[model samples]
Target: MPEPTYRQILYASRSEAGIDVDHILQQSRHNNAVDGITGLLWHDGDHFVQVIEGPESSIAATYARIAIDPRHHDVTILSDRPVGAREFGYWSMERAGKSMQDGAVMLARLERRLTNAPETVRQAFTAATKR
Candidate 1:
């Protein structure tokens, strides 16, 4: 059989001054599951960072929707590329809500399992998610 076509994308954006994390997660989980996407999201008071993985077409379509979302601005794609496997296979959309220090520790553990991700993407993940 041919290898599964998987792609991972990392992006950063400035969240609206008072965006609701719970609401975003709830919507994302539902939308992603319907599209067969899986990923993780991290948001601090000022910024948002997300990594999504799935088929190329679905990733593109989902990102197109995200790029136009009014809740965030100055969105920038940090990395986007094809991968050998899923880095976040289990979660439809896991939100990292711990303090920055604790979030960094959590990301460190997750980094080990994301061997297929580029070093730049991993570095951005750490920087974006940590204080």
Candidate 2:
């Protein structure tokens, strides 16, 4: 097979107290759109599970920024690998959370997104959303 052109990073983190998730989502959408990145960000009240995928350079730069962001702590990487194509290709940054009014719908969509993801990545999201 040909080499993968995209890099994907799946990670989980503990959200810092009083951090504005709305602001973070807004900022991420803008940045990811400009940088040609796409992914899902599932943030419960106290934790985060995300899957970011894009060009190799963009993914590297984006992950670098995320690594130093103050909104979250203990940013543990669940998976880092390359893919031949984008998996979460529909959104620049889609936000999912149990706090939403349409949470069941959001979770169903999230399950679809993780349908082909690694078991560990899927489990991380499952655990976080359940909390």
Candidate 3:
């Protein structure tokens, strides 16, 4: 069967701003073992966006590798759609670490997951993002 067309994927995670992404990307090299892996890494306020493209199998397989890799965790898919340009332009891992301002990303996600946060808190976050 022909491979599925590549899909655009945008994901984010929050971690310490000082975290070294260079190290993370290098670690993934041997672990993922998939060829043509290339991408860009960027961070803003602790939020990260990574664009990776290639064979669907490679993408899916690498995601598994990323999840298991100790370098990163709590990954979230913010947006995904078919885009004309492959932002990453390669199949390698682009580890975009966190920024200090967006440090709340993990806390916010955890709040939603545990269902311990109040409605007002969630609403405030939503309102803040819209602006």
How high is each candidate's TM-score?
0.81, 0.79, 0.51
**By lDDT: ranked, best first:** 2, 1, 3
Give all candidates' CA lDDT scores: 0.79, 0.83, 0.49
Tens digit per residue, CA lDDT, model 3, 15-76: 45677766766765554445544554444444444555555566677666655655455566
Cα distance off (Å), candidate 3, residue 6: 1.3
lDDT of 3 at 84: 45
Q: What would the per-residue lDDT of candidate 2 be over residues 31-101, giving only the tens digit for each residue?
A: 99999999988888888888899999999999999989988988877778787888789999988878767
lDDT of 1 by residue, 1-131 (tens): 88897988878788888888889899999999998899888787777878889998899999999999999987878767787788778899988745755676556645554467677666665665563
Clashes of 3: 7
Mind sharing the TM-score for model 2? 0.79
Off by over 4 Å in 1: 98-102, 109-127
In angstroms, how far off is 30's CA in candidate 3?
6.4
By lDDT, who's the top model here?
A: 2
What lDDT score is found at residue 71 in candidate 2?
Answer: 82
Looking at candidate 1, the ten consecutive residues that score lowest on lDDT are 105-114
Model 2 worst lDDT window (10 residues): 106-115
